[model samples]
Every structure is written in structure tokens, then in C-alpha cells.
Target chain A: MTARAAMGVLLASLAGGAGYADELLPYRIEGNAVPVSLTGKPGDAARGRTIVTNRTLGLCLLCHSGPFPEERFQGNLAPDMRGAGTRWSTGELRLRMVDSHRLNPDTIMPAYYMIDGLNLVAPAFRGKPLLTAEQIEDVVAFLATLRD
Target chain B: MKRFHALMCAVVLAAVAGPAGSADIPLDQRRSGYADLGRDTKAMQDDDTSNPASLGVQDGEALWSQKAGTAGKACAECHGDAAASMKGVAARYPAFSPARKGPIDLEQRINLCRTENQKAEPLAFESRELLALTAYIGRQSRGMPIVQSDARLTSAIDAGRKLFTQRIGQISLSCAQCHDDNWGKQLASSLVPQGHPTGYPIYRLEWQSLGSLQRRLRNCMIGMRAEPYAYGAPESVELELYLMWRARGLTVETPGVRP
Candidate 1:
């Protein structure tokens, strides 16, 4: 798809707003299981990289250090992601992004997609998930390319 | 591959060499920010001359005596000698209030007194005069231990505890995640204190002024990407009650200096 079309799809996905209740998605945890794409298209790694580095969006660097040396002040709270691509498959990365609590009940990482069973969420964000499904796919795509 | 191996080794070594246990105190018996402050900031709090919050206390003292409203009564007129009357008062708040039928912090209590007792307009939360008066009143309790009671505030305290542990916002962090679980651990570049309410209205260099405890709470909520409650919201008061109870025996360090 053209860059403009990709941007249009991303904007449309995000415009779902915070009002609608989150629709649960079904996916298997088996190795290399690919969930159905909400955006109905491949993700752009450039956009994915932007989501991973943006503090307001991804905030991955707040806890997890990555290979982005240009970005100063990466956090040391969680494991570094220098070779994330080689460490985990894209499907595994997707599950972690969607709902990490399924894997580890005690993780401090936020679920970028799942919205059920939250507390004290702002009225504006009561039912909405943090990132759109396309954005999660974009981040997954970006993490898949982190192999050095 | 070599870099990855080195990184793994560093992680393993760090895990094996866990944080020292010598200075680690149980969560219930932690020290106040006064003890956690760096040397320079602690010195600033020790000396009135260098303490910026002292200026607010001075302003608050003036406001205490100034006549206001139709009644034209100063805070000193009814509650004469703040050094004595106000002493240890701050440490007992967010206490249960019969009138409000809920928990009320020192800030809200002051506002209630202004509107009901003094017949004056209630000061806006975080206003200069409000913070000044709060700092002044709180300063009187400087070394007094925080004395929150769960006797009449069990429900409110319980609610606050839930809020403390409940994850919210886009970032999905609860107060316990940083302040409870990782207190004293470095986040970004700063050490996370045990989320106590012992040193407010505190003098934060980041704020460059004295601010109410609610202001600090709102800042945390925003940082976690959660929508903050309104200044006088009961949820904020509930959270304050929980924090005060959590810091039960810690001495009040009003006009506290923090980085």
C-alpha cells in the first residue's frame, strides 16, 4: 500500500476513540500463531519504530532499554531489548504486546490492547485500550527488526 | 552475539548481587523524606534562612491575622496562638469529618473552616494563600508523628488501599508498583519514596514552591497517564487517608524540601 493509504488506515483505527467498549480478540498462544489483522494490511516498520520510541505512545523505553542510542535516558527497570527480534518470534511478541499478564501475572508492563478488569481509569479512557490494534501490530513489526 | 552474552552476564550478576539488606526497613516502618533527602536539600530544610517554604509560612502567618469576610474575624481570633492550637493538627488529617460525612485533608478542612467558621470565601486548592496557610498550619506540626486512625475511616481507608493497588491509565501503573514495590529504587534518575504523605505541603524544587498533597497526587496520576480527580474530590481524600495511615508513625516534615 502507498504511504498515504497506510497513514489513513492508522488514523482510522485510532479514531475509534476512547468511548467504545473494547471488543475482545481471540488468538492462540501456540508458537508462530498469527492473529487476524485489524488493519487488514501489513504494518510499516518506520511507523512501528515511531510508536516504540514515542514516550506518550509506546513508553517501552521507560522500563525496557533498547538499541536506540540516539534517544537519551533509556530506563533500566525491565530487560533490555537489544536483540528482541532473535529472542522471540513475531507471534510471541504480539501476545506480549496485547496482554503480557497472560504470561506473567506479576509484570508491571501495561497491556496495550486488553481493556477488561481495569481500575481508576479516567472517564475519558474508561472503555478504550491504550493503543489501537494497528499500532500494536506496528510495534510488533518494529520489535521484530531489532536483531543486530 | 558477544554483546548479547555480555548483557546477559551483567543481568545475571546484578540479580545475584541483589540490593543490600542493611538499610532496608519494613514498609510499615520506613523513614520520611526528611531522612531520604540528599545533604544539600536536608540542610535547606534544617535552616529557615535557606528554606523556600519558610516564605510561605511567613505569608500564612500574615493571612492568619488578617481580618476577612462579613464576620471580619482573623483565624487568630477564634483559634488564638497557632503554635499551640494548630500544633499536631495536620498530622491527624485526612480525618473523618462529620459535616462532610467523609475523610477531609488539611487543605479541605482549612477551606471548610474558612467558609463555615470564618464566613469567608473558600480558598481555591493550590492557591498561593491556601498553600501558604496550609504550610503555616502544617509547619506547627513539623516534628509530630502522622496519627491517622482507621477506626471511623475503615471504609475510606479500604477504598484508598484499592486505589493504591489498582492499575489504571494507558501506562497501567498503580501507586504500589513504583512507591510500594520499588520504593528506594531508581526510576529514570530519581529514587522513589514510599509514597508517604508525611512531607506536604512540601517544597519541591521541581515545583519551585509549596504545594498541597493533592497537587502531588494529581501530578502522579498524570504521570501514570490517568485522569486526575478534581482538587476536592473524595477519591483524592480517600487516597490521602490511605497514605497517611501507611506513614502512620513517620514524623510530619511540613515545609519539607525535596528534589
Candidate 2:
């Protein structure tokens, strides 16, 4: 493809993909607002791992240590997540992933489904949550299965 | 841009010009407080670096010296000798790049070199390669002054300064709160410095490898319970520039051993 054409294609792709993901995970963010969805299937640990490792899914291993078939991909920044289930209760894990500040207040973790509202952000994220209710539940289910 | 400027104007107006007496601590204790904090920080620096984490630094050194990629430009080619070549490089970064026309920290600069010069894919922020490269690069300026400055950096400096003072994390602790308001305060076992940018690209004993300024900022954001700026994003660059300015007088300690 010509350079100009490629540039056009890239721009078009970006424009098209801009907020489409939100269609499936409809949510918003307003300054410091938290997004919590009390909904979804409790994910199977095995299935959750697939999503966690999936490049388009949770992508948790990007900054977290975890036991997975993909050993080469684990990050060393945090403690190994292999035995997380042994340490944290399911409720604790859910809260930590969903919005860690509720627990530690000083944690650097993002509000998965919650939007730590940015009043100056945009109208779309002004008062909405970040993760859709369903994605939060899916991620929660996945986190629950991190035993061993 | 206008709104952001307006926000900045308000912030600058609200800034307490000079250091104020500590509201929480006793008056006399506040005087020697910073000095005592320094001692505590030095103590925390005594990490057991003789472990797996230290191994990452060795790998980074190897990677820094290795000549791979299509252009055959190992970092050594342009950077020259790692030990002598990178002196004071890390501290001056998050500064404006004439070529890129924006502020870029050392990690992004390295990635730009890799992708454009080496013809390689950019490493992810948390990747081992990025960590190793950061460590090796930092090692080059172990004892130099951070000394970041440029006339073209006014706007970036302003933006970064705003970011440093703005409280965004769920914990509501701005960079200023810890590094400015309580530079010598103890947060658990750790003593907070003025958030100096010295010894960057240094081998952090905790991660057991070298990390870039952006990585450190991201970690700080996590520590503050804030959403991290994405790797290589403009916000991160702006923040980096501000940090460089904040640590202006500190010497560069790139690739230094840290606990």
C-alpha cells in the first residue's frame, strides 16, 4: 500500500474503533467516580486464565506476576499472583480488582469497572463507569480462579 | 488547550509560594525532620540486591552491548561506550526532543531508537527488555547531575508542574503531597524524598532490573491509587518533564544500584 493510503487506513481504523469497544462495555467516567456492576457469571478459573492472557481481554499479566502456561509473559513488578486465591478471599479479590482504593486507599490499581471520575474529561466519561457491569463480573470471575 | 490553561492559571495562583510550616508535626521536629528522613531513606536503600532482581541488571548490560536488529545499531553504536557514553543522559530526559517535537523520557527515546534505528518493535513498558535497557542506560550516569534544561521546554514544564500538583489518584495524594509537603515523611518503612529523578534507568532492587522514569511514574500512580498514564503517552511525557524540572539540581545517577 502507498504511504498515503496506509496513513489513511490507519486513521480510518482508529476513528472507527474509537468508542466501539464501549458498545459492548458501555460505561463512563466522571472525575473520581467509581464504576461498579454487581452482575455476570462467576468465571471458571481455567476459562478466566484464557481471558486474562488474551491480548484483547483482561491482559492482567502485563504488570502482574501469575502462573500461566505463558511463563515468558509474566511481569515481575508485583508479587506472583499464582497463589492469590490462597491469600485473598473472593470478595477481597473482587474489590481489589474492581476498585482497590476501597481497600488500600493508597493503591495504584485502576478502577476496572469504576471510573475515578475526571470532571474535565468528556461528557461521555463525565459520570459513567469505566468497565461495563458485565466485564467487571467476568474479570471478577476470572480473578477468583487464580488459585494454584 | 484554553480550558487546560485556565485550570493551570488557577492552580498556579493557588500554589503556596514558599515552604510552609508543617501543619501536622511539632514546630521543632519539622526543622530536623527532612534530615532524619534522609537517614531513613539511606537505610531503606540497603536492599538485598544480590538476588534474582540483580540478575536483570546483568542481562540489561548484555542487551545494551549486543548488536542486533536490521540496522545493526546496537545502543552502543550511537550511545557509544555504555559506561562513558550515557553519563548524565537519564537525568536530562523527559525533556523536549527536537526530532520528535515533544517531551520524551529516556524509555520512549530508547524505544524510538530501537524502532526507527534498530528496526525493532517497541518493548512493552513492563517487558524485561525495557527493564534491562533502562537499567543499563541508567548505569551510564551513575554519579552525574540530573541537570535537565531547555528554553523550548516552557510549555511542557508548565504542564508537568500542573500534573505534579494535581491530585488525581483515588488516594488523593498529589506528587506534591509526598515529595513536596512531606519530602522527609515516612510512609510505612520508606522515606519519601523530594521525588528526585536521580539514579534513573537505575537498577531498582525491588524489580531486580532497570526501569525508566515513566515506569517509576506509573508505579507512583499505582501507589497513590491513581489510574496510570499509558506508556509513551503525552501525559506521561509532560509529567516527566515536570519531574526533571523538580529534580533540577540533583546529580544524574543513571544505572545506579538502588534498594
Candidate 3:
């Protein structure tokens, strides 16, 4: 392998591992809301719905009941997802999607976009948030559509 | 007037001693983890002959009288006929231990008995041998109410109660969130139980083997993405004690089969 090619390979591996996982874009929280978008683009509500209802990726249904009629089991830990959009503005939802702990310290909801202040996170998942910035926007968009 | 005064006094005492074990869930509504189990699993637990954990029970029976160690003593020799002597013993465990100067779970108690009386090495945690013995001893207390009210365990129990509500891990979930507040509600496809420690050496379908309450607690911590406490850690024993206290009036269902 050539030196230039080897450098390229190393860069690729770095991008795929901890280097990528640790890259969390700073977002401003303004009065219980993130007024700006993380991806600099509006999220796809349809894609957001998929993330919300997925068993593994999002696990939102693990604690919150929602309008997914096909999903047989829905959690009762948190408030229902119905009418969420009607309850809060898009910005407020965005802040919540990032870190609900800022809203309520006693909340059991995990910080989807935070890496600090967590206790004993598994080694494999260390420094990794439960959701990426784009994924958080997607979920926020889907939750916002629950206004009806 | 006299009758009303006596009734009011009784009410005041009852209020002072309300079922703090159940916390907020009414006494009648505090369902055991067994209730959340499937019908087939419940059936399996009910029938000792059919229960897979019964195998562990048999293993324990064999170990009871089998002499071992330098002293060459058997548990049965010291405490003969588990039916009589061991009855209700396991139910009150995670009790105060004079030797440890702290709380010790049933597994630790067995090890203590082995080392002190039999002059044997302590069995490893989560080992088949220890599970078997624990199952046997736990079975002896089957159907008996879990009783634990030692004054020495006050601080430890208080710590456990605090831990139960304290959030942990990246998920930042607490025991009270899932097992205490939202119990009987569905978490994905599984029904969350109140998490009473009525059964130890329980046979889980996922494991296809019997495991101790400590093992189960470790699994729960892992579920929260938190590092689990070491087998004989003080925190783990204290948590076990608090769980037993939470399940005070519940009947023991050792060697319980669950899916």
C-alpha cells in the first residue's frame, strides 16, 4: 500500500470510529428551546416517524405511548405523545429532544444528545449519545406532527 | 365518644405505619413480579416436578449432607432436616450479620456457613453449586412471608431506598421509574412488574438456568447501561435487603420459573 493511500485508509477508519462519535455540534439553548436546527435543514417527518416507532433505534415507545396504531405495546412511563405538537413549539421540542434533564433533573428520560454527567455508561457506548443530531431533529419533527 | 376516640387512635397509628414498602401503590395493587409472568411460566413455577429449577433444588439436597473441606462437615450435620430448620430462614435473609458488621445476602450467608463451619472455600458467585444450594434453602421458605426488620439494617436500608430512586447510567433511569411508578404498564412488549424479590434462585427462560437475585439486579443495572455492582458488594446486598423489605408481606416463591 502507498503512503498516501495508507493515510486515506487511516482517515476513513478514524471517521468511522471514536473521531466521528465524539463530534457533537454545539447547539444554543435559548430559554428552554433550541431556536436553530442542528442539521441546518428541516427534518423529514416521515423518516422521523420511522425512528420514533423503531424498537431499537429510538425506543421512544419504550416509555411513551403514541399514535402508532399498529404497534401493540406502548409504554406508560411518561406522558402520551398525542397532542405534543399542540402543547409545545418546534423550538421547545428541539431542546427536549436534545436534553430533557435541563427541563427536569428528576426525569428518567435519557439525554439523546449529551455525553456528560452520565454514570457508568457501557464502554462500547461511552461518549456516544443515544441519538445523533440529525436523528434528534427527525424525532422532533415527527413528535411535532402529533399536534392533531 | 369512647369508641370514636379509640378508633381515631388506631387510625393515627396505622397512618404512621402505612405500607411504605409498597410506597404509593396500594397494598392490594402491589402485584409481585410473578403476576407479570406468562401463564405457562406461572404453571411451571407452581409444579415442582415440572419446574426446571427443581433440578437445582435436587442438587442442593445432595449438597446438604455431602461432607466437604478440611473439617469434613455437612450442612445437614450441623442443621439437620432443612424442612424444619431451614424453614423461614431464607425469607428473613439479607439480614444483619455480626461477622460482616453489615448486611449479607443469602449467597454470602451460605459462604459464611461453609467457611466457618465446614472449613471450605467460599463458592464463586453465580456458580451452579451456589445457585443449587440457594435454591434449596430458598425453597424451604417457599410460601412464607419475607420478614426483615433488624435495627442494625436501618442505615443500609435507607441507603438502598435512596439508591432505588437515584438515576444511573447514560439512560439515567431509576428503579422507581420502571419498577415502582410505572409497574403493570408495558415497556415495549414486556409488562413491567413491581419487582418484589419474592423469589431468588429464579429460573429465567432467557437464561435457561437458575440465577440469584443479585444476578438479576446486575442485569437490571446493565439494562440501564450502568456498570453492575460486584457480586458481594455492599450496595448489592443493601439493595437486596431493601427489595426484601419492599416485599415484606409477599410469600416466598423460590426456584420460581419465569419467561
Candidate 4:
């Protein structure tokens, strides 16, 4: 295995001796999308909405303004989240959620799924993804519901 | 009000990232992080009596006169009244150090005096003594404009500017992204400031104690999930040089209280 892969295994072992840390399952980026549901089925959009609005959980509104009228405040850094589903396919959104760095290396969007190549990760979040795969699906499902 | 600041961040980032150190901005556009604070916090910084950091300054005043090291010499012996001697000292760092052949921040310069001048062991970074001393000295420069005084180290400044704009960590964001690009905007519940290096060692609400500029920088590095430089590291000094240069003309507000 590559040095990078070995390091991942080490971190996984550190998590617990199961060779699975946060259980970041394999997912392929076909072109610009994952092309398959991370949980093998679409997630609950209602649950996804809760995650999106949560400051600690999704933190999406911290950088992207959306149609959440009740939020009272939202960020203006990245593109607006309005009409997100109308713009990108569900798989495309999933890939972006997983890691937008592949599309724009300098993008400030955090990779919610991938854990390798990160630095100074706080001990509490050392072996964890920003969002679990289940949470990623929920967010993806919520984003898929956005329309003009 | 540089209303175009939102658009200018990308332009600024592009410029700062490409050239050696092109973090330069028009004088009209530079806004101190103070501009983003709530009224209560600003009021606290304005009032010496009410400011919690005033306590640290009091400790620093005592430290200045107290003798230390084998020589048992006090800072007052050589520097005289801090009010007069240190008036513009903090405002002019991280200045180029002629002896060291690079830039040195106020904190490092203070430690340097301890080890080299007083024959005392240098104070640890962020130690109460260091913070108190720095807080006291920084208070002398309050309301004085931040001035750049470098004989050389333009290369170091360039390196710092590059570091400011270079993307890092799991988040893949640079300093310029949130600070330069998105200052004046809300992130979660807090307002993003322009990331100026004025008025430190500041009394941060999160830390609940006086802390140096390096401490604040480390906080951001950790928040960004990027590896932070060691205290007084070359990278930290260079970043300080660049930030001081960028903050030129902003008034010092030492022992600043912030949420």
C-alpha cells in the first residue's frame, strides 16, 4: 500500500482496532459526481434540512445563503444555495459535498467525507469525517430538493 | 466603506498569492478588526478602568520595575519610564532586527532583552510574565498609528503574504478567504474581522486572558485545520511583519477586549 494509505490505516487503528475509522466507505468520482447514493438510497430530506440549518452540524449557511427564511442571518461568501437542485444533478451535489477541492483546489468548502491529507485536526475530530456518510446522504437529499 | 471589498478579496488574494508579497491595499480600504466588534466590547476596550485587560497591564507595570536574572537588573533601570521609552516601540514591530538579520515581533524582542541584555532566562511564550510585559508595553502605544520600520526583510514580508493567501488544511481555505474576502460578513454567529494585528496582547473572551498575536494566529490555524507554527517561529514572525505592514496607520489599542 502507498504511504498515504498506510497512514490512513494507522489512523484507523488509532480509532479502534477494526481498520475502520468513521467508516469512510469507498466511493468513486465518475466525472464530477459520485453517481450512486452513499447509503444505497436517497436520504430523508426533512432530516437533511435540520442538518443544513444547524450551525455546528452543516455550517452550510455560514458560507452559503439559502432559502431558509427563519435563519435571520446567512453568509455571503460562496454562491447562494437557492436553486441548488435545479443546477446540479444529485450525484454532482454528492461529489461537491464529499470534496469540492477536486473542482476548485482553492475553494474554502470543507470536505465532509474524506479524512486523509488533513493536518492539525483537533483530537476530538481526529479520526472523524466532518459528516458521516449517512449525514452526507441527508445533506445531499436536502440539496436535491432545492429548486428555483 | 470599501463596499467593493467583497469583490476585492478575490483580486487581493490573487495578487497576494502570485507576487512575492503583494498584500498591499489602498489606504482607504484598510479596516481594523475593531470595526466589527459590538458596542459593549468596544466600550470595554475604550475604558481603561472597565477593561479586564487593565489588570494585566498593572501586572506588567510591576514586572517592569522588579529586578530579575544574575544581574538583578530591572527593565526600569535601562528603559526608564515605560510611558516614554515604550511609547512607539510596539507600534513599530515586528521590525527588522539588525543583529538577527530578520524580523522580530514585540514578544520575541522582549524575551531577547531578558536573555541577552539582563542575562535572565527568556520568558516562555504566552507565559503570564510575557503577556503582562507585552500588554504593558503595548498600552504605551495605544492610539498611536501602527508604523512600519524595517531596514530589510521585504523577502520575509513577501513570504508572509504568500502564507496569508495560500490555501491549507482539510477546509482548503487561506487566511485571505475569510479575512480579506469575507470581512464584515457573518460566519455562524460571529462577524468576521479584517484580521489586523493591532492591539495585542488582546484579552480574548474565549481565552479569558491576555494573549499575543501568535496565539490568535494559532487559533485561526486550528480553526482552519491547518498546522500552526511554533511560538516565535520564523513563519510566525514573517506573518507578523506582513500583518504590521498591512496594518500601517491603524491606531494601537493595546489590551483590547474582544468576543
Report lDDT (CA) for all predictions.
Answer: 0.79, 0.60, 0.84, 0.83
Give the per-residue Cα lDDT of candidate 3 at B43.
91
Q: What is the C-alpha lDDT profile of model 4 across A79-143, one tens digit per residue?
A: 89889999999999999999887887767788888787775565556666778788889999999
lDDT score at residue A57, model 4, on the 0-100 scale: 77
Looking at model 3, give its docking quality level.
medium
DockQ of 4: 0.39
Identify the superior model by DockQ, candidate 2 or candidate 4: 4
How good is the docking of model 2, by CAPRI class? incorrect
lDDT of 3 by residue, B77-98 (tens): 9899999999999999998888
Q: Score the docking of each candidate (DockQ).
A: 0.30, 0.03, 0.50, 0.39
Residue pairs clashing in model 3 are: none
Superposition error at B189 for model 4 (Å): 1.2
Q: Model 3, stretches more than 4 Å misplaced? A: A1-20, B1-28
Candidate 4: list runs displaced more than 4 Å. Answer: A1-32, A67-73, A115-129, B1-25, B149-151
* Candidate order by decreasing DockQ: 3, 4, 1, 2
Query: In model 1, what lDDT does residue B200 have?
Result: 86
lDDT tens digits, residue span B46-158, model 2: 34353233455577778887876788768877777777777667657775688867788777878888888899888888688887777666666655655654646666776
* TM-score of predicted chain B versus true chain B for each candidate: 0.88, 0.73, 0.90, 0.90
**Predicted candidate 4 versus true structure: per-residue lDDT over B80-119, tens digit per residue:** 9999999999998887788988888888889889998889
Q: Can you tell me the CAPRI class of model 1?
A: acceptable
Better of 1 and 4 by lDDT: 4
